[model samples]
Target: MINSKFVKQKEVSISVPPGIDDGQMVRLSGMGEALEGGVPGDLYVKIHVRKHPYFRKEGFNLVTEMEVKLSEALLGADKVVATLDGEITLKVPSGTKHGMILRVKNKGVPLGGNRRGDIYIRISVQIPEKLSKEAKKLIEELKKEGL
Candidate 1:
């Protein structure tokens, strides 16, 4: 429902299409002002999408960042990630580097019918700020092995 000075206050049905971006306009024909013996003007409504705390949209694709420990990046691990549908487990291959993007197919924005976009997860390798003596020794040993 909307209130307009040029038209009577009434309820208007607006169907938002899938994958519509912010600032896009939806025109409502014959819903504006009408003059004597003249056609009524159209009403234009602009869309504004609120930002998500965990994901950002790009086209139909959704992007998010995931932090992995240094050991996890070096070794393979299965991590649980939150998705629009629900939570899913993602596999991080061994030797996965920082800034590597992993794609989960058909997990993004709806594309009408039965199609959907993809979700991109960017890996962020977290290095420990403070290392224990034993951990430092193990890293030193790895360095000696040309790791």
Candidate 2:
């Protein structure tokens, strides 16, 4: 509550609706200043959503980046991803490229009723900085094989 010359300062708890966007307003009737003979005005509260450390919101969907090893990108591997609900195992298909997006259904923001959005996982392949001699030789062989 803000101190105002017309309205009295009083704290009130307001329940925000789920999946509400930032800068959206929530109106509370009869929560504002009371006139001499008129009804009380409505109070509007603007919402501001804090940025998450990892997840980014798009509509109701949540997007996040996951780093995978080069070998894992080449060969299929099971990867664990953190969602708003919890951690889930995602299968990375073989030959998965960098920036590949994998969608996990029903793991995103909750819509009205029992419906929910999905989570998109952006894949980031991490290549080895240094390689052993044998590893380098195998890579050279792969290069010769048009890899």
Candidate 3:
């Protein structure tokens, strides 16, 4: 709650709505300097939302990224990802490539009126910097098989 001092020492209450974007302003009517006849001016309250650690806002949608192992990219794997709701298991398709996008429905910011946005997850495949001798042999075998 904020106290605003208008003319005649009158105070007004302003409530900011949720899901407001940064640099957006909320206007309060008749809460500014008063005119001669007791008419008041309007007051604008600017809003600022702090950055979130795990998510970013794009319009009404949310975006985040998750890392997947190289083996998971070759073969399908189930991954538990963090969303607005909570941690949920998502199916990482077999042969999924790096920088693939996965969508989680209705897991974004609130849009009001009982509506919400979606969350997009970018898959980052972790490549092993140094492959073991056995791992290199297996990769060569798979390449020979045209996989």
Candidate 4:
């Protein structure tokens, strides 16, 4: 019989092997017995396999990082896709500052009962990894102009 006081809390994903019946009584080795019964009782469990990538906190939106090209960052494009999901394009405004937050209402996590959360896009400026001679010369010219 499983002990009643041995239950532990878990936050991450857990997979139950196939052929497990729904509403079946089972206990983890460490998880204890169910209440009201001196003997061990079947432990209740809920299984969910997949989840979205973003984690949300109240009063704050969350999204993965995405780097914009120098021209894109300077000109400020209309939308930039998130790295985790390329199809989810987040809009950007002109003169967007680095780390600027763009909030999309109701584009976030599901709060149940048909309610949803928000999504935020953080702007990032990207620099070229390897600069061609012409690019380097342009940078030098810009430096001369104190730009």
Candidate 5:
């Protein structure tokens, strides 16, 4: 009831009255956040609900893992774009080893209700403390093709 505006306002989302703290965002009076020309709307209650310390969600899915280094896992890494839902792309497989586990279906974590959660990238192959001479002759010719 910002002052009753005739009639033609229907946009609400209000939901942050539980002590507010997630990140904080609850400033509403008449919910005015439409803005287009007749401008007159504002209703957003995103009380800091974007938690991603290290990525860990099970509902609406979201997991985290990616440490490929050994030359991008034997030079085979291009579809590894996902800083936590950059759309969805995970296909790290050149020599991708060391616990390899890449899955980015759905992109995980929406929980709005429709349901959508999936993002797991656990690959770790990086062991080059100090090997330069052409990467130690390509790791001794890939250990004589033994890889």
Candidate 6:
């Protein structure tokens, strides 16, 4: 419901179709008031989509970032990632580098005709922000071993 000076307090119904991009306009025929004997004006609604906290749209594809532990980056692990549909397990390959993109097929926005774009997950390895004494010792040992 929207309030305007032109139309005191009236409820308007708008039907938005799928595949409508942000800033696209949807026309509502005969919704605006006519001038004297003239025909009613058409109402154009500009669409604005809010940003998702865990997902971003790139064209038709959906992009998101997943944070993996340092150990998981070094020794592969099956981690749960959030998608538009829901949570799913993604296999993290060993020796995976930061910012590497993993593609999940057909998980993006619909592009009409049953076809959809892919979902890309960018890997972000999370290093320990604080290291304990034992953790520091292990790192020193690995450093001494030329790791």
Candidate closest to the true structure, highest lDDT: 1
Q: Each model's RMSD to truth, in Å?
A: 4.2, 3.3, 5.1, 9.2, 11.4, 4.6
In candidate 4, position 63 carries an lDDT of 63
Clash pairs detected, candidate 6: none
Give a tens-digit lDDT track for model 3, residues 1-147: 898654365566778775689999999987776756888788888888889998999988999998999999889899998877789999999989999999988778888888888999999999999999999999999999997
lDDT of 6 by residue, 14-74 (tens): 9887657899999999887787799989888899988889889998899999899988998
For model 2, residues 1-147, the per-residue Cα lDDT tens digits are 997575457989999988889999999998877778989889999999999899999999999999999999999899988888778899999999999999999988999899999999999999899999999999999999999
Ranking according to lDDT, highest score first: 1, 2, 3, 6, 5, 4
For residues 17-125, write the lDDT of model 5, one tens digit per residue: 5223466677775466454566556554656666667676655556777677887788787654555445445567786789877787656665455556677777778
- The C-alpha TM-scores of every prediction are 0.86, 0.90, 0.80, 0.51, 0.33, 0.78
Better of 3 and 4 by lDDT: 3
User: How should the candidates be ordered by TM-score, best one leading?
Assistant: 2, 1, 3, 6, 4, 5
Q: What's the C-alpha lDDT at position 78 in model 4? A: 64
The candidate that wins on TM-score is 2
Tell me which of candidates 4 and 5 scores higher on lDDT. Answer: 5
Relative to the true structure, how large is the alpha-carbon lDDT of every model? 0.94, 0.92, 0.88, 0.58, 0.66, 0.87
Sequence-dependent TM-score of model 6 = 0.78
- Expressed as tens digits, the lDDT of each residue in 74-143 for candidate 1 is 9979999998899999999999999999999999999999999999999999999999999999999999
Candidate 4's residue-wise lDDT over 1-147, tens digit each?
A: 975566557664344653233344444543446556566554456644343454334432446555667767666676645432235656565556678777777655555565666666666777789999999999899889986
